[model samples]
Target: MAKVIMTCGNLCSGKSTYAEKLGKELRAVVLSIDELMTTVLGRELGDMHDEYVRRCEQYLYKKAAETALAGTDVIIDWGFWKKAQRGYAREFFRQQGIDCEFHYIAVSNEEWERRIAARNAEVLNGRSDVYHIDSGLLEKFRTMFEEPDRQEMDMWIE
Candidate 1:
């Protein structure tokens, strides 16, 4: 039986890196919205970015289930910032009769800021396709992200 590993974290919390390593260890398929969005749409969605992300996530959720059912473990490299989003993912897999684990990557404010700078440099240097977190974008996500309680996570990575 295959399992689903869902990553829960804020922006630049190293979820993608963690998922990639875990995917390799588990022989799982890693699905990421940022990878999909940036590869297909190329970063200039503007006001439509949120809508595009929602659609992409829906598609990935279906794909994850399909891959899991085919006996391959799946890693969802997503920032399940809201509790509702995490809950929905758990229930979605539960109803599918697939085991699911939520791995939360917790980072301090100092570390997060440092990571933002590093990631921004990488993006600006054309070395990475990930989104660059501007002040406005940072503030938006900071206000939007609802930190998950410890009990809600199956694994916690600092």
Candidate 2:
């Protein structure tokens, strides 16, 4: 049976990197919300992206359930930065009876800054579309994220 593994972290915290590696390690289908949003809309979401992101996230989670039913593991790389969102997700997965777990990669502010700088250079050179977010934005999310503690999720990556 296929299971769902979700990775959540602030921007530049290497969420995608870990998801990709885990997907390959588990032989699962990696579903990236950012990449999918761009593909579906033909552009990266703008400043008012919360609504679109929420909708797309719902779509992908539903798709993950469907994918699991089809007998393929699904790995979701994204962050649910709100308590309601996290609650909804847990309920949704429970309803679908899909095995689900959440992982978090803890990174120091200094390390995040370094990665952001590195990613910014790549973006500037057109070698990557991955954007480097501002430190303030990450700090805001750190406070906002519902934060799946070990008790809230099936598993929590320390």
Candidate 3:
């Protein structure tokens, strides 16, 4: 049976890197909202960012269900930042009879900050398609991101 591997983490937490590794191990397709959004919108959505992200996520979830039903494993590299989002994803897959695993990429604040700096440098150099986390955005994300408790995660990677 196919399984959906959902990644849960905050920004710059290495979800995409882990997703790529896991996808190779499971021989599955890795879908990333950041990759999709950056490809289509060139990494800047401005005021409509949240709305666009929601739309993109909905589309990806539909694609994931279809792919899982087809017997192919999938790794979704979205920052499932809230408990409600995690619950919704699990229930959605359960309703479709697809197995779902939640993997939380736990990163220390120091490490996360380091990664953000590195990523921002890459973005500045045009070496990556990811958006740079400025101070305001970082603070906003910190306030908005919901850290998952141990009970909510199937596996934790640090």
Candidate 4:
């Protein structure tokens, strides 16, 4: 049976990269909010960004369920930043009668800083389509991300 693979991590933790490789390995469709938001919405949402993210997530959730129900595995390449969010994702799949796995990508501060610098450089060079993590944005995410316990994860990648 097909399943949903949800990735959990902080910003710049390589969830998207992992999902791409996993999708190829598992023959799953990868769904990404950043891809959608960047290609469609751009950076002008400002204060409404959070609200847009909420709606975008809902849409992705629906599509993921549908794809999984159709017997195609799906990978959600988003930072399931909070435990509650992780719980909600699991419950959502449970209610859909679809199995799901939580894959957490744990990164050290040094590696995360390195990734942020690399990604920001790509964004500055117009080579990447994701949000640039400024110091303020980094601080905001630092406070927002609630790391999951080991027991909550089905797979842990360091």
Candidate 5:
């Protein structure tokens, strides 16, 4: 049986939403790296530097591996931004004969701007402590985001 499903997308791209939906559909455990990074690192991952991000990502991946090895289905919600990240994840799942699918959540710039505006408003209102996306930040991320293709992902939604 398949044990791994990687949900890939940039920030504010609805990856978490679709991951939750897929988790419900598959009855799998959705391992949100964002949540882990926020809780464990005591800060939103978006605020972390590359080295810190890599460390946090490693911990998340290790946990996912453990969860899947325990026979629980795992859905990871993250950008999986670089090929190295996806390659490592794919190899780990392949070695275990665990099924893997990638869902690339896609959204328009308008949607992303809307989401960021709403989120930033929440931050300003004291509803959140971190992860405030300014007006141009979403555009910045979109610019840098590299979509995962067939070579890195077997399937995509969006």
Candidate 6:
């Protein structure tokens, strides 16, 4: 049975890195919202960033369902930060008669901060396609992200 693996984590929590590894291990296609947004929108969406991300996520969710229905596994690297979002994803796949698994990547604050700094440096050096996180953006993401409890996740990577 094909399945959708959803990644839950905060910024710089290594969601994309883990998704890449898991996708290869599971022989799944990795659908990354960040890659989609950055490739199409040039790494920055400004004031409409959230709205744009929401739209992209909707599209990806539909595509993931289609792919899974075709008997191919998919790994969504969107950082499903909120419990409601995770619930919706689970139900969406359930309604399609597809299996879904939630994987949460847990990172300590110190490590997360260090990773963010390194990522920012990579972006600055033009060595990565990811967006740099400033103080304001970091705070915004911190406030927006909702940590998931153990029961909400099928797998945990710390």
Which runs in model 6 stand beyond 4 Å of their true positions? none
lDDT of 3 at 58: 97
lDDT values of the candidates? 0.93, 0.78, 0.93, 0.94, 0.76, 0.91
RMSD to true structure for each model, in Å: 1.0, 2.3, 1.0, 1.0, 2.6, 1.0
Better of 2 and 6 by TM-score: 6
Candidate 1, residues 1-158, lDDT tens digits: the string is 99899999999899999999999999899999889998998889989989999999999999999999999999999999899999899899899899999999999988998999999999999998777889998899889999999999999999
Residue 120 in candidate 5 has what lDDT? Answer: 85
In model 2, what is the error at residue 85, expressed in angstroms? 2.1
4 against 5, candidate with superior lDDT: 4
Segments of candidate 2 deviating more than 4 angstroms? 42-44, 132-143
Q: Lowest lDDT 10-mer window, candidate 4?
A: 36-45
Give the per-residue Cα lDDT of candidate 6 at 31. Answer: 99
> What C-alpha lDDT, on a 0 to 100 scale, does residue 104 get in candidate 2?
72
Identify the candidate with maximal lDDT: 4
- lDDT of prediction 4: 0.94
Screening candidate 6 with a backbone cut-off below 3 angstroms (N, C-alpha, C), the clashing residue pairs are none
For lDDT, candidate 4 versus 6, the one ahead is 4
**Looking at model 5, which ten-residue stretch has the lowest summed lDDT?**
42-51
TM-score of each: 0.96, 0.85, 0.96, 0.96, 0.82, 0.96
Q: Tens digits of per-residue lDDT for model 4 on 7-47?
A: 99999998999999999999999999889888889877999
Clashes within 3 Å, all models in order? 0, 0, 0, 0, 0, 0
Over 24-54, each residue of candidate 6 has an lDDT whose tens digit, in order, gives 9989999999889988887657799889989
Against the true structure, candidate 2 reaches a TM-score of 0.85
Per-residue lDDT of 103-144 in model 2, one digit per residue for the tens? 776677788678878887897899987655566765775577
Candidate 6 matches the true fold with a TM-score of 0.96
